[model samples]
Target: MPAKTKTSFHKPATWSDVAPLLVDVAMGRQKADLVVRNGRWVNVHSGEIIPATDIAIAGGRFAYCGPDASHAIGEGTRVVDAAGRYLVPGLCDAHMHVESGMVTVTEFCRAVIPHGTTSMFIDPHEIANVLGLEGVRLMHDEATAQPVNVYVQMPSCVPSAPGLENAGAALGPKEVNEAMAWDNIIGLGEVMNFPGVAANDATMRGEIAATVAAGRTVGGHYASPDLGLPFHGYVAGGPEDDHEGTRAEDAIARVRQGMKAMLRLGSAWYDVASQVKAVTEQGLDPRNFILCTDDSHSGTLVKDGHMDRVVRHAIAQGLNPITAIQMATLNTAQHFRLERELGSIAPGRLADFLIVSDLAALTIDEVYGRGVRLARNGQLEIDIPAWSYPASARNTVKLGHRLAAKDFDIAAPKGTREARARVIGVIENQAPTRALEADLPVAKGIVGMDRRNDVCQIALVERHRGTGAVVNGFVSGFGYTQDCAMASTVAHDSHHMIVVGTNKQDMAAAANRLGQVGGGVIMFSKGKELALVEMPIAGLMSDERAEIVAEKAEKLTRAMRDMGCSLNNAYMQHSLLALVVIPELRISDVGIVDVTQFAKVDLFV
Candidate 1:
């Protein structure tokens, strides 16, 4: 009898093939493809640090890991001496947005590979909002082309919030079911509509049901602090894991409710330290908790690190080194139902691991993906090709006509000299905002920004439809002391045009500047452009190299700081001004959204 035909040489072998290969390699009947010699394995399954372990690889899978692989290694087999280093499993990002890095998928992989990130579960909802299902397919296809493992999560909410906001594109239950059949799509992306879930909205439930029916995990984003009936209802709606918790109790509650607790440490979000206490102080099961970076910008990925930085932060927050590594590795894999294929250095798993010189320092000397060295000494050793999207992704910033100062003017009430206005107060390093009220003097029949009180005007331009609609409101957290404006087309969920400035002239200039350059971020101060980061791809991400994007992002940050804006990671705060899905106050194309009420409210009372 002849053997069966296989799809690919590197594909996971059937039990019969893997079982035979294991026994043959152990008995020296078959030569191993590669052998990693003399290393201390950080065994996540048993929580033991086993020294003098050898890992043998064949067909891109681990065939044997024991005291020695000398018999398995023949003249044709390659050998890599670990030199008594720590063999840690390749890091995995459980939840992340590739667009937040402001680079293409290939560029993001290139940037994080050196940091020992071997697997990523990406939510391309940003692009989904821009180009609909076609955008998601583009991301999924590009993810498949990468050398490292990059899985896609079908976007659960394209517009994010129905009725409350309108995105460039919309997705529903049909799209969810269609995406589930794709080879690269592992599950559904973050279901951001907590209100709908709590109210048993049909659309939200339908999407969740489709994901569940497909036997895939449902990502969650319950941004509200009310972990009461609403949280319980969302959990019951079938979201398997959530990363929006910012408190210790939030982590404890999620784990208690049989949902995985994902603690994120992004470039701006400082959430891990507060939530990780559930395990360190409250004595919760660490197995139910995972570490992730929900959104990381190019500057952080280039200058700092990726999952390695998150693991180090977890360790510094009073977690044991092995435990922290497990949160970023095995814990994430288990939640995604990919434990057998990844997240550990055991037999029958993909041969992906990192060689670290110091466990305490986490200094990665080499990174391996599928038994191949991808990075060495903090730089990528492998060449990853760049990918390009269709022309539809470019020139996304459609302002209808060039914006002017008059478009931002807020007309005062007929005879009103003074008015109290609802202002969106940005909370530094968090997603939620405070609904603040401020008294302002009406001048020349127009309501103006109170610069003396650090108040600035915010406007949302409908860029997708070219409606030329500018919804005006006030925001009081950037602390800008100059007559400057910051404009971006990367507004969250909706991806509309957001302009914030003290003076309307600079606002117009900044808005028009992005319009002229296709789409990107621009900072204009005193009528002169201070910084511009061109994101021609969907007006959200740049197609340039990661390092180039990081340089431009650094300039944008410095320019914001130079103009007296002092909130930490103010760029993240700036981009999220139009995110109506989160809480308290936000601006949209329709009107100023009082998210606490989940309805549009008057800017002035």
Candidate 2:
């Protein structure tokens, strides 16, 4: 009933003013606002569980956390009997993109609260590419107004790769400095230009210098699997944490270089299983590692879980539940220098925690944020206010003109019948794509789709500038084998329209359809629309509730399956198809990018 005070979470400086009141409650001079009794405290700090623990909260913070809170309780105090359940610190997602959830920050908070994710460190570079600094400001204010802790990392790479593609907006060291002064910006977002950083490029190094000078952390994205000198050079460049490791060695190398190894298990990326082996088998310090979901679509957030899902998956992958919990909670907080703030259930910390019936299974029975009971039994108990994006933030799908089947034509050499072309080979359930080559048959000078080898057409349609420039390329591994096409404006980094189909007509239809409704994902099959989840907000996020988006996303997944595309969380793969920062090959507005070389390559070899 407390209106879920934002000052309690966002404005931690106010805690200095309120700490005296909490001290009074601890000393039994003042009555506590809320108290929990007879619970097993999963003390992440000590890596052990203490039984029959009692906690007293005042001013949305823990005043007393000991065996008994009877001295602090009074007639005005609201008591909740834990009934001998595990009292765990609320889970925290160290690194994520709120836009990846296909919902706004408020909606994302609402969806994940029931799953016991009380805190998130989000990098809004996706929106930064669309609306620039003003766009980030909108989300920052929204994040600050939430019932939970949502920290923003200033986007370090707006275009992601400098010359590879053009984003809607551009940010540099000046923008980074301006954003560092924000109340909620904990650090600079993932320094994705690993090549630039390794080479000591002025802009990339300047942004890192500014973030470090501001005394904030620098998020890392060393997508390269090579643990050689390039990786060493990047680590020396001052990125404190990295979530791009997809191998056990990658995790080991990062932690050895004094960077936090963030093990992520998003809807599509299964990096945790391979990387957590660094801790389980190699016996590295688990504290040097963190857990995160780099990107999860709406369905994963609502149907599965958030950080809770990641923690459980880690446990199932030979990690101790308490250690996995530590990886998700205290480790993350410590990475962002928030350990003394909200990662644990200690005195002087916010009363943000969870009541779990099973630690190993992570069955969250109740969720709390800043001492407020936000959810219970996998359902939200309190109201999470809705946030509306301004008109400037909507209708961002700017296609210069309607596209037709001829627009997707990939012409071959004048006299060639079959041409060897460079193709972006998608690896299933992984973030990295393979640079593949295939000989394709040419029809009327245009390259044709190879359905027998599961290859289809992938094009990046210019949406930001409305140039109507369609960059055509080939991609295999979706297993799509029908007269179907899937298009989305949720293209990573640049937020362009990525259209993939076995038939060019359907691909053109899908692109034109998104142009009509601002932006979103759509699947067109056999000359009919199968599914559409209208985002309308910068072509990335939906204004609808989390459940509605999740349902539509489910239908979209069904449509992908119906069209013979069999890849887990294929939507995530589709979105990242245009992310040129990640290797080995990707399509961009410029042309097909060979991410390994970080340069544009000829479509035909």
Relative to the true structure, how large is the alpha-carbon lDDT of every model? 0.90, 0.92
lDDT string, candidate 1, 353-450, tens digits: 99999997799999998888888888787667668888988888889998889999999878999878999999999988889999888999999789
Tens digits of per-residue lDDT for model 2, 252-319: 99999999999999999999999999989999999999999999889999999999999999999999
Per model, state how many residue pairs clash.
0, 0
Indicate the TM-score of model 2.
0.98
Task: Quantify how close model 2 is to the true structure by its C-alpha RMSD in Å.
Answer: 1.9
Clash pairs, candidate 2, are: none
TM-score of each: 0.97, 0.98
Q: Residue 290 lDDT in model 1?
A: 93
RMSD of each: 4.2, 1.9
Best by lDDT, which number?
2
